[model samples]
Every structure is written in structure tokens, then in C-alpha cells.
Target: MPLKLYLLPILTLFIMTFSSCSKKDSGSAVKPTEEGLKVSLTNVTEASYTAAAGSTYTFQAAVTSKLPSSGVNITVKAVTDPGGVNIPQNAVAPSTSGAIAITLIGLEPLRTVLVTVVITSTSNPDNTITKTFWITNKAE
Candidate 1:
């Protein structure tokens, strides 16, 4: 009889403890979100680039980051080089803050070539941005 009485109190206490506990709304907790880098072609408007055959065009790009001083790495590549397009620097580390210069030379007359430029934060690999520019080499 006494054991039953003790067990009843203990069970009640356990139930009460659990009943008092409540779950918190996970949505209410603030989370830090990363805003990736922003990239744009400085010289060209509307991301369009054109150059005559046997001519060279310079594509100047600028990058901005939410986190300052986070060194950035840039990659400039022609989607398909048909033996006429030459990119001297495929990879570059900007000496200035997010200033990149990509020069494309059309050795011979060719069609439109898609050039892709990708910028990634050295500090955060996931923070990256890609921009594509179309280069057309028209016969002069």
C-alpha cells in the first residue's frame, strides 16, 4: 500500500515534468545566410561582346562581395574554342578588388563563342557567381 502511494507521486512528478516541457518554433530562430558574390561586365552593356576577326576585344569585369577582404578567384574560358579564339589567362587573381580583365583574340573569322566567367570567394568556396558573355567574330 505504501509502495503504491510512493509510485503514484513519482509517476505524477514525471508526468508533470514532461508536460511542462514545450517545443520551440524552429522558424523563430534566426539563421545566418550567406549572400553570394555579385559579378558584372564593366565595359559591355547587356553582357554582349563583339569583335571583328583578327581583332582583340577586352572584357572588363567587376565583382562585389558581402564580405570584404575575402580574396576572390576568377576563371575565364571560351565554351568552345574553334582554333581562332585565344585566352591568355584562363585563371587569374585580381590585383585590385574584384577587377578582372579578359582579353579575347579572334585569329580567324568565326561564329559566336560563348565565354563563361566564374568568380569564387577564396574564403568561401560556396560563394560564387557565374556570368556568360557572347563573343562574335564578324569578318572584317
Candidate 2:
């Protein structure tokens, strides 16, 4: 028999062995939960800022969740990229039945403010979700 005939059979066996080992080493994959938790920014209203060079403003955010009846705990924060904004220190933990309100104070004029609401499940502390909203001051 020619060397080419022996070469083909040896190559075929080598390929099959490598493929089978790869599949087994990959291990079992976990499917994501279809009915897992989710969070949404319900409302952002009563937002106003002063036109003066130095002034104060108040902003509010409403957060809601679709967790179980027991509800999920969340931490809502107001963040700004430009800086010099005051977000409340207290963190809110909203219930499933009702939404939570977060207040931000002392925002500067002609600046953009980014508000972020982060929701974390008390049941699963490792799981966390976040949503953001942008507010721009009207030109004076």
C-alpha cells in the first residue's frame, strides 16, 4: 500500500479524538432564568434649575421593579459627570407595590446631570441592575 493511504486513516483518527475531548471539557452550560427580576425608571419629574451663576435645584426619580411579592431592595443615586452636584446620602429600598423617590439637590446652572438608579435583589445580592437619566439646564 502507498504511504498516502496510511496517512489518511491516521489523520482521521487524530481529528475525531480531539473533537470528542473538547466537547466533554466544555462542561454543562446554565440557562438564564426566563422569569428573573427586572427594574425600570418609572418617572423623572419636577425637575428645575435656577438660571443664576450659583443656584440650587431639586430633581426627583421614581424607580419600580418586577420582583416577587416580597419585593426587592434597591439603591438609587444621582450622579453627574461635570461634578459639583449634591446627591442625598440615604439609599432607598423600594417595595414591589410602590415606587421609591430619590431627590438630588444643589445642581448648578447650564450643566448636564446624569441620574442613575441601581436596583439589587435582597434575595440575590450579587445580582444588580441600573438605569440612568440625563437632565440639562435651560440656557438663561
Candidate 3:
């Protein structure tokens, strides 16, 4: 057999490979839009709160049905005065439920612990919702 026969088969396979990858219907489905999931939190409805100095307060959010049952995430990002209070970084919502809790320990009087709740659809991280809340340490 001529060497050209082997080269011919190899060239055909290479072309097929490239063509398969470029096809519009190469087993690829249209991706769903990142419209995001509907979500709501029953807790922390107030925009601002106050806590006595040297006290610990926990803000619990009640979220159910308003969000997806799976692939959901929640995070508490402290924007200011984190050093004056103890707080958490991030948490994942339970697959069966959407309940989030944020605990703040007040340290300095008159100082504010400002934070934002960053909720993201784990399936579509690009889709997100953020809410800002703050806690001011009350003076004696």
C-alpha cells in the first residue's frame, strides 16, 4: 500500500474532528438564561439595627419557597467596623431550606458593624442579589 493511503485516512479523521466540534448541534443544548431564582428573607427586614455594647445579637432570616431548594448560597460581607464586632464570612443554604443567620458581637460603643447579604444562585453565580444592613453599638 502507498504511504498516501495512511496519510489520507489521518487527514479525513482530522477534518471530521474539527467539523464535529464546530457544528451547531454537536450535542450542545441552548443554555438557560441567568435570570436567577426568586428569593426573599423574612429576617432582617429593617435596614438598620442597634445593639448595646458588649452584647451579642443574632439576625436570623426566614427564607422558604421564595428561593430554589438547591444550589443556593448566602454570604455576609462586612463593609465597615468588622474589627469592632465578630461576624461570619459565608454560608450555604440547606438544600431543603433557605434559612440564614448572622451573629454580631458588639465591642465598641457608637461603632457600627455594617454588612451586606450577598445571595447568589449557585447554579448561576452571575445572578445575585445584595442587601445592606448595619448594627450600631449603643452607648451607655
Candidate 4:
């Protein structure tokens, strides 16, 4: 066989391998324009909270988003007693000042509940954040 014939096949294979391995500009692809929601508890300074048993504990939170939101959805769950916590409102419109009220009443005394609060931005439901805290009912 001629040397040029062998070189031609090898050169073709080398060129094909290098061309397929070339870097691609994947960064230029279009991405979804979604922003995350920000939630902050304004009244609760600590991660955990305590309140008198049989009394309603009211707290304020601030939620903001860069994009316009239809409203905010607040879901609360009591790890200790699912039926013990009472929520007056779960869905609320976005506040201009980004302030919302979260009220909870502990029905049992000397009981601790692990409260999970999930705040979801209606504009982008996927962009949600969760806040988990413990709440204890104390004797009045």
C-alpha cells in the first residue's frame, strides 16, 4: 500500500475526531426569565416562637419579587397537630409594602409544634421558599 493512502485515512479520522470535540457556545441559548421570591419574618426575631395556649399569635412577614405576582400563597402545616392550627386566610394579594399577616392559635397547652410555612409566588410557582420553625404553647 502507498504511504499516502494510509495517511489519508488517518488524517480523515483525526480531523473528524477534533471537529466533533470542538467547544459549543451553549451559553447563548435562551433561558426562562424567572425570579425567586423573598420572604422575611418581620415580627419574629428568632427562629422559634412561643405563645400562650388558646391565644392567637399574630406575626407579620414581608414577601417581595422582582417580577409581578398575581398573589402569594401561604401554606402552613403543624407537625405535632395537623388539626390544631387554624389559618384564617391562606391566599392574599401582594402588598405594596410587602407585608403580610400570619396568625396561629395553639389549641393545646404544653405542646410543641413544628410549623412549616411555604410561601409561593403566584407569578412563578416554581420559585418558592420554605420557612420551618418550632412553636411551643405555654401556660397563660
Candidate 5:
């Protein structure tokens, strides 16, 4: 009985030490959530990577939430290309819940054009996300 009693105390001490060492660290900074809006271009038909002058290319713009909460109150307001490529200014989205159809005219030649799409959350108007796509306009 005396031997068993001594072993019990030793076993209890070992278990306590092991558990204390296994405790998770709480000193790390809380990482911010990466949830946000996402944008994609689709339905770009009958066009090559090189933009041809006077050629019209169409694309369907889609917006969704990486987090479900964002999908509810999102607004895609405009699409612009500052690289001298032609795009409709203040282009309206056909459907707030669906994709927006975007059109561009291959006007000036740009080695690379950055097509920027801007979207905002109505719930959080200050929160905005910009997505850019690259295209090229070829000079004849």
C-alpha cells in the first residue's frame, strides 16, 4: 500500500508536467479574416490576346463573396482601363445579383492594359475592392 501511494504521486506529477507543456500559446496576434469580394471575367468571345483596332470584345463580369456575408450587399459600379484602351465609363451592371456585361473597343495600341473593376459593399460603403485584368492592344 505504501509503494502504490508513492507511485500515485509520481504519476500525478508526470501527468501535470506533460499537460502544462502541451498548452497552446496565446501570445500570437489574431490574424485578420481574409474574407472579401472576388471578381472574374468571362464570356470573352471571338478575340485573341492581341487587341485589334476597331474590334469589339465582350466580357461578362462576375462578383461574389469569398465570405457569404459580402455577397448580400455588393455593388459593382465601374470598369475602367487607364492604359489607353477603350472601355465603357461608369458602366452599369445588368444584374446586381448576377454578372455584368462589359464591352471594350480596341482603340489605341498598348503593350499591356490593366482593366480595373471596382466594387463596393453597400453595407460597408467604405470597404472597396479593385480587381485588375491584363490585356494587350496591338498596333497594325
Candidate 6:
């Protein structure tokens, strides 16, 4: 055999040996944290009013944060089962100490209005949270 043939086999063996020896270490499992951020809806109320046919009602929501006060934004939405309610166009950030208030409009009579407050950290976008409550309209 020519010397070139032996050289090719030796090179191939050397490459294979190094490649087989290379290994990746799998990382260990991450433990869950004991401390967690908490958000609460405080002093939430709707204006005392009656809704008539073809009329609109406004509901208000107030939210407070029990964790860090910075970088928290609140968005309020009103949802019906049929999905015909209109939500707010923009999200509002807490002006003081993670406190925000949102108002929803165009509510119908004899319908359940679901108010959802979504609290998100602008600093850490992935750390988003939400809370929901419902208000019912009765015929006057």
C-alpha cells in the first residue's frame, strides 16, 4: 500500500478518537424558590348605576402589588362569554407604590362583566401575572 493510504486511515482514527472522547455535561435540576411575588386587587368597586337597554355602564378596578413596586404595569379588560365587550386600548402603570386604577366602558345590561387586571413587570417581561373578578348587571 502507498504511504498516502496509511496516512488517510491514521488521520481518520485520530479524528474519531478525539470526537468520541468529547462529552457534554447535563446540568442539574433547578430547585423551586420559596419566596414569590404576590399581587392583589384592593378596593375594587363599580359605580352604583343601573344599565338600561342600549345603554352603557362603566366598571372600575384597582390593583395593588405586595412585592416590588417598580416596573409594574396594569391593564384592565372586560370580557363576556360571547366576547362582544370592548377592552381598554392602553395599559396603565402604577403612579405610586404599585397602585393603579382602570375603568371599563360599554357594558350591557343583564350580562356578566369579567374584569381582568394583568400585572406585568416592565423590567422583567416574563414575570407577568393576572387576576380576574366579575360584576353582574341586573334589570332596574
Best by TM-score: 4
Candidate 4 local distance difference test against the native: 0.65
Tens digits of per-residue lDDT for model 5 on 6-56? 998999999999988986888997645545667666753222233434344
Model 3 weakest 10-residue run by lDDT:
87-96
Candidate 1 colliding pairs, count? 0
Q: Per-residue lDDT of 1-140 in model 3, one digit per residue for the tens?
A: 68887998999999999988874756876656654545554444456665545555567655543565345677766544646445544454444356666665533566677767677776667767777767665765
- lDDT tens digits, residues 1-140, model 4? 69977998999999999999999987885646566777877655446765545545567767655633466677766656444554333443454446778776543566666666787766667878888766666765
Best by lDDT: 1
What lDDT does the true structure give each of the candidates? 0.66, 0.55, 0.61, 0.65, 0.53, 0.56
TM-score of each: 0.58, 0.48, 0.56, 0.58, 0.44, 0.53
- Model 2 residue 65 distance off true place after TM-score fit, in angstroms: 6.2
Better of 1 and 4 by lDDT: 1
Residue lDDT tens for model 1, 1-140? 89987998899999999988978677885534567777778655536665545456676877665543656777777654455455444455653476777776543456666677777777667777888767766775
Task: State residue 47's C-alpha deviation in candidate 4, in Å.
Answer: 3.6
Model 1 ranges off by over 4 Å: 1-35, 45-49, 81-90, 94-96
Give the worst 10-residue stretch by lDDT in candidate 6.
Answer: 46-55
Better of 2 and 4 by lDDT: 4
Which whole-number lDDT from 0 to 100 does residue 137 have in model 3? 59
